[model samples]
Target chain A: MGTWVQTMLVIMLIHLTAGTPVWAVLGQAKASVEKDRAAMGGQVQSKLAPGYSVETITVVGMTIKEYVSLDGTVFAVTWKGTGVPNLRLLFDAYFDEYLDALTELQNKKPRLRRPLMLKTENLVIERSGHARNMWGRAFIPSHLPAMVSPKDIQ
Target chain B: MAYRAVVIACLWFVSACGSSGGGNGSAGPQPPNVLTVTVGGSSVCRIVNQLCTQVTICQPGTSTCQTISDILVDTGSIGVRIFGSVLSIPLQQEVESPGHPIGECVSFIDGSALWGSVQLADVVLAGEPAVTVPIHVIAPTFAGQSPSQNPCNSVVDSDPRTAGFNGILGIGLFTHDCGISCEINDNNNLYFSCVASTCGSIAAPLPTQVQNPVWLLPSDNNGVILTLPNVPAMGAPVLSGSVILGIGTASNNSPPPGISTFTTDQNGFLTTIYNGTTFAQSIIDTGSNGYFFPDSTLPLCPMPDQDFYCPSAAADLSAAIFGVNAGRATVPFQVANTANLLQTGNAVFNNLGGPSSSFDWGLPFFLGRVVFVGIEGQLSTLGTGPLYAF
Candidate 1:
C-alpha cells in the first residue's frame, strides 16, 4: 500500500480506538480526570489553588498533571518522565488534532530537529527534552481560568 | 575575521590551544583517543549546531567493518542507534529467547521516536578498541510491525534524510539506555519482544539491552572529554572540535586542575535557579541544538522559527546551576534574534536559544569549553561517574 494510504488507515484506527472511556479528559468535565487516573493505574493527588485545582498522578516513572477550573472543567495537561505518556488518553478528543498538527510541522522544509511548539487556534502544546528525560505541556487557551496563566500549568 | 585569525594562530602555536585542545604536538601522528567532531561544513548533518562524528561498526568479531559519517554525538541519551538504510554489514540480531527477536523504541524530546531491532555489533570510536555490544538498528518495518505499533506511540523517522543524521552515538552518563528500569518493569514501553508479526512489551535483562559502547571498551571506558572552540556572537559557517574518549585514563584525557565537578542524578539532571524560580530538572546536553529555558521576557521568533527566541536585540542572561553534590556555578549566556542569526547563512551560533520548561545547556554551551562527562559507577580524576566537569 502507498504511504499516504497507510497513514490514513492508521489515523482511522486511532480514531476508532479513541472512543474508550479513558479518552477525552483534556476538554472534558473534572470527572474524566478520575477515569484517566484509573486507566493509567496511578494515584491521584489533587491540590487546590485559588481559582483552580491541580490533579497530579504519579505512575511508573511518569508524572501527569491535570488542571481544572473553578467550574470543574479540565483546562490543561502536563507530563514529564522517562518516556512520553499515551497522548490518546491525555488529549482525548483533541488527540487527532495534535497528530495532524505534528504531521504538518514535521513536513516543513529545511527540516530541523528540535523541540516541538505546536500552536493551533484553540490548543497550545509544547514538548521538549531528550531520551530518558522528557517533558511537555498542553492547554486549551479558551478554557483557562481568568486568574490562571499558561505558565502556571507547569 | 577575528575568530579566523584565532584559528590560524592556534594552528601555528598548537600549545596555545590549552590542555583541552586535541593536539598531538610533534608526537608521531594524530592521537588514537581523539575523534574529530564537526558542525555543518561537509557533514551530512544539515541542522544548525548539530555535532557530527564518524563511527565504525563491524559484524561482531569479523573484519567486515563500515565507517559511517554524520553520526550525531549526543550527550543526552544512551547507546548507539544507526539507521538500517545506512548500515551495509549484516549484524547478529539480539534475541529474547529463541525465535523472538528483541526490538526497541527510543523516544526523543522532539516528539519523534526511533523503532528498530536490537543487533549486536563491534563498535569502534576513534582509536579505541572495538567493543562488542548490542546497538539499535533503525528499521520502521521491523518484524512486520507498523509504525503505529511502536511502543513510543509516536512518529518514527523512516530514513536518515528525515532524521538529519545517519545515527546517534549516545555517550551519556548512563551505561544502558533503559538501565535497571527496563530490567525490572515489563511496562517500561522501551523494550519489546517480537514474535512473528507482532511485538509485545517485555522486561529485557541488562545484558540484552543496548549499551553505551564506551562502557564496553577495553580501555578509556570511564568517560569522554568534548572540546569545541568558541564562536562569535553572530554565528559561524562551521565549527570543529574533538571527542576525546576516557577521562584521566590517558594523559590527553586528563582533567585540568581546578575544574569544577557536578554530580547528577541517575537520569543526568541538575538544578538551575533562573529568574527567581528553581528548575530542578535542568540538564547539560550536547544533543539539544540550542539553549532552552523558560524566559517570558524574551519574545519568540515568527512562524517557521517560532520555536526559537527572537529578541529584538541580543539579550545577555545568567543562571545559577546547582549540582546534587552542592557544586554551584553561575553561567552567563546570550540569546540573539533567530531572524537575524538565520540571515548569516551560518550553521553554528553561540547565542541561539529557545524556550523550555527547564534549563537545557545545549550545544551552544559546549562552545569554548572542554566538558567532561563521567559515566555512572566509573571513577576518574573528577571523582566518580555520573558527574559533569568543565
Candidate 2:
C-alpha cells in the first residue's frame, strides 16, 4: 500500500538514542568553531533582507492545558520541525490531567465570567541539549545536536 | 559529565511532560540533521476564509500578538491551534489522564470531529527558540458548541477567511500524539480513542487520522523541502521559507528536483502519485491547510460533505513531481481539478486531508516556499531519502 505506508516509518536510532531521556536532550552543539555571525546582531544597521525572527520555547516546567486562545493567527507560522511540537505537548499533558473538573467549572464559577481572562504564563525558552531543562529554560546549550548514540545508528 | 548528567536530570526530570512538541521525529536507520529556521511574515485578508494571510504570534503572555493569519505551516498535527472562546491567551483544554479531560474527538477531512484541548503553549517560531511545545487547540469549536457546522453555510467555508488559513504550524518530525502509535498501538485510534464527555477511547483505526507533525524533527526528522517565490503569476503567493531543520543536515539537503523518495510505510504513510492519483498514503502535514482529497466527482470546492472530487475532473490546483528513487524534486500538489484528487469535506472551504486515502500537502504548501523535509533515515550528501522541495 505504498510499502504498507513505508512500514510505519521504519524505526530504530536506538529508537532515538535508546528512546529518549538524556537530560531529555538539553543541548550540546557549540563546539567553539565560532561561525554564526551575520554581521553580529541585527537592527542598528538595516535590511540585508531581514524578516522572520520568531522564537517561542516553553517546555521546562510546563503549564498550558485544555485549549482555545484566540484573537487571531490561530495557527500557521510553522517554519518546520515536527512531532507537531511534541504532539501538542502530549495533548497538553493529557488535557492537564483531564480538564480538572471541567476547568473547575470555569475556575469555580463567578457566573462564568466573560471576555476571556487567563493568566498563567511561563514560556521561557533558550535551551538546547534536546530541550528538557527549566532553570527558567535559559538554555543556550549551544543550539543542540550531538547525542548520536545507538551504536551510531546510521 | 554526561553534559553534567543532563543538568542534573533537569532538576529531577518529569516536569516538561506535555504542553507541546513531538509527533514522529527520531526513529532510525539514518535521518536527522536539519536546521533552517526562517521567519518574518505577512499576507492578510481573512474575513472568515475569503483571502487569508498571516503569521504574527505574540501570546507568550500577550500585549497583543495574534495574527496567525492564513497559517497551514503544519508537519502533520502536533500543536499550535487557535480559534477562541475569547483570547490573547485564554485558550485552555487540559486532561491527558486523570479521567481523560483535555477533551475533543479529532478526525477532520470534513468528516467532522475536531473538538478541542490537548493544548499548552510557549511555541514562538521565527528563527527558532521559544520552545514550550505541546499544541493542538484546533477549534471548529465548542463552548456550548456552535462554531457553526456549515458545509458552505457561512460561505468562505470553515470561516477564518475561507480557510485560506489563519492556523496550522505543525513543525514536523515527531515527538507526540500517536507516534509509537499513540504510545504503542491501541488500534482503536482517536489517537487511541476519545469521543466526548471531554472525549476518550472509541476509535479503532490503523491510520484513519492523526499523522502530521512533519515527520518528527529533532532536526529534520525526515521529509520536507518546500521553497517558493516562483510567482508563476501570484498563483503561489502564500510564500515564506526556512524549515530546513533535518534530513541528514546540509549539503543543501541533497536529493531534489522531481519528487519520489518513499520510505514511510509503517504508519508514516507516503504512497505517492498525487495529481494523477495512485495513493496509499500522504502525510507530510504542517497541519494540513490544503491538498485534501475525497470525492463526489471532480473539480471540487462544492461542499455539504464528501468530495475529494476525483471522478477525474481535476483542475484548480494540480502538480506532482515527488522524487525518491533518484532523490528530490517534490512538487506533489493537486486538486486544482480532477475529481477525488485530494478528497475530504464538510467544507472548511477545502483541504481537510483527503478521502481516507491520504494527500495532505498542508502548510499552504509551505507558503512563499522553500521546502526540504528529510529526516526519516538520513544520509544526505544529497542521497538516502525523505522529501519535499523547491
Candidate 3:
C-alpha cells in the first residue's frame, strides 16, 4: 500500500511534467533542457562552481537554472525574472508534493502576502517576489550531495 | 483636472444611500465617485479577510450588461478580471496577428495562478464608463486548452467555486498589467495567442493588452481612495467601506495637507523598514488579508495556521514606510494569534498579520484609514502618477 501510494503520487505529478527523478544523469537533464528550449524560447547558458555546475536556460523574459552535482546528476532548480516559468516543468514529479504543502499552508492562512516557503519531508520550495519580478527555487533535500548546500542552488 | 471636494462628498453620501444592492447604473451625475466594498458578505463563499465589490460589465457598444458581485478588489495587481464561468455576456475576444485568440496566465504573489483569455468589454465601476478596454475572462479551458498546456500552477484550478470568490478586480497603481514586458517579448508567458486549439505565447501590443479600467475613465481617471472603517481587535462578522475614485480631483478624495505620500518605482514598489531591516519592494496591497512581514520574535500557530504570525498575546509593532523621493512615515500595527481570531464569527480584523519577506500592508492596514493609489504617469493634486498616500 505504501508503494501504491507513492506510485499514485507519481502518477498525479506526471500529469504536470515528465515524472523525472532526482540524481538522474546529466543526459536526462539535457533532454529536459532541449524540451524546455523547444517549448520556451531563449538560449541555454552554463556556469561552473566549485563542487557543482549550473545550467541556465534563458527564456523570453525569465531564466531557469538547473543545479547538477559534480557526478553529473541534476539535483535542484531555480528561476527568476519578469515572467514565471512553467513550474510544472521545472519541478516535475516533485511539483505535486509542493502543491500539497502549499494547499495546506494556504488553507491555514488564506490571503497571505508572504513569499511561499513550502517544506515537505524530502523537498523544499521557496518562492518570493511580487508580479513581474517573481523568483523561486525547488530541490530534493535528500538527493543533494555531501558538498552541496541548499543555498548553492540559488 | 480637479473637482470641488464638497461636491464629491455630497454625491458620495447620496449614492451610498441610494444603491442598496448591486446593479448596472449610468455615468451621469453619479461620477463613479463612491463604490461600497464589502468584506466577507457572502455566506456560502465565506472567504475570510476578503474585500469584495460589485462590478457591472457590459457588452461593448450595447446596453446588455451584467453586474457581478463578490468580485475581489485587489491592489496587489492591476486589470479588471472575471471568471468565464460566471460571465453571462458574450464579449468579443482579442486576437493577435496570426488571428489566434489571446490568452493570459496571471500569477499571484502567493504562487497561485489565473489562466484565461483576453476579451473586450465596457467595465462600469460606480458610475464611470471605462469604454472598450481589454479584460481577462478566466476560462481554463479557453479555446479547448487543456490543464497540462496551462502555464500556471493549478492551486484553485482557476475556478471561482474553489477559489471562494466570484472574480478579482485589480486596480493597483499601474496603467497596464505586465506593461512593456509583454509588448516586447512573447516568451514572458503572461500573454499568448491561440491558433486552432494550441495557444502559444505572443507579444501583445499595448493598445490590445489588458488595462487597469480605472485609468481609462474619461474623467476622474487619475486614481482611487479606499476608505474602510476600523474593526475591533476581536474582529467583526462583516465590514463595509467605500472606494472613492480620483485623487485631489474632488474634495472628498483629495489628499489632505497632513497626509503622507510615498512615491513608487516603475513596478509600483515602495520601501518598508521593519525591525530596522529595509524591504525596498514593499507595497500597500488590500488584496493581501493580513499585514505580512517576517519577524523572528512572533510565534506562528501550530500545524495549519503556521503561515500567519500567532503570538500568545497581541504584539504591537512599528515600521517606517519610505518613498523613492526620500519621504518616510512610520506606521504602528498589531498581530494576533490566527487560531484564536478564527474562532470568532468576525470576518474582519485590524490586528491580523502574517510572515512574509516583503512588508505587505493588506486589508488589515486599510481599516481606520483612507489609502490613496495614484495612477502611473497621471497628474493629481497629490503630485504625479505612481504614488501611495494615507
Off by over 4 Å in 3: A1-40, A43-60, A63-76, A103-114, A142-154, B1-31, B146-149, B153-158
Task: Please rank every candidate by lDDT, starting with the best.
Answer: 1, 3, 2
Tens digit of per-residue lDDT, candidate 2, span B1-390: 000111111111111211122111122212223222222223222211122212333333332233343454445444455544223444334444444444333332321224444554444332222333445554544323333431111111233333334455544433344343334323212332233422333322213233334343344345555443322211332323344454445565555565344444333445556457654445555433345544334543354222224323334545453443443243534344312322321112232223423344554455454555544345544444433334
- Grade the docking of candidate 2: incorrect
Interface RMSD of each: 2.0, 16.8, 2.6
What DockQ results do all the predictions give, each relative to the true complex?
0.35, 0.01, 0.35
Model 2 bad stretches (over 4 Å): A1-154, B1-71, B75-171, B174-177, B181-198, B201-206, B213-222, B228-371, B375-390
User: What is candidate 3's lDDT per residue for B299-373, written digit by digit as tens?
Assistant: 988866777778999998999998987568989988988889987867889988777655778888899998999
Could you give candidate 1's per-residue lDDT for residues B31-95 as a string of tens digits? 76788788986435888889988777777767566667778899989999999888878899999
Instruction: Please list the C-alpha lDDT of all candidates, in the order they appear.
Output: 0.80, 0.32, 0.74
Cα deviation of B23 in candidate 3 (Å)? 8.6
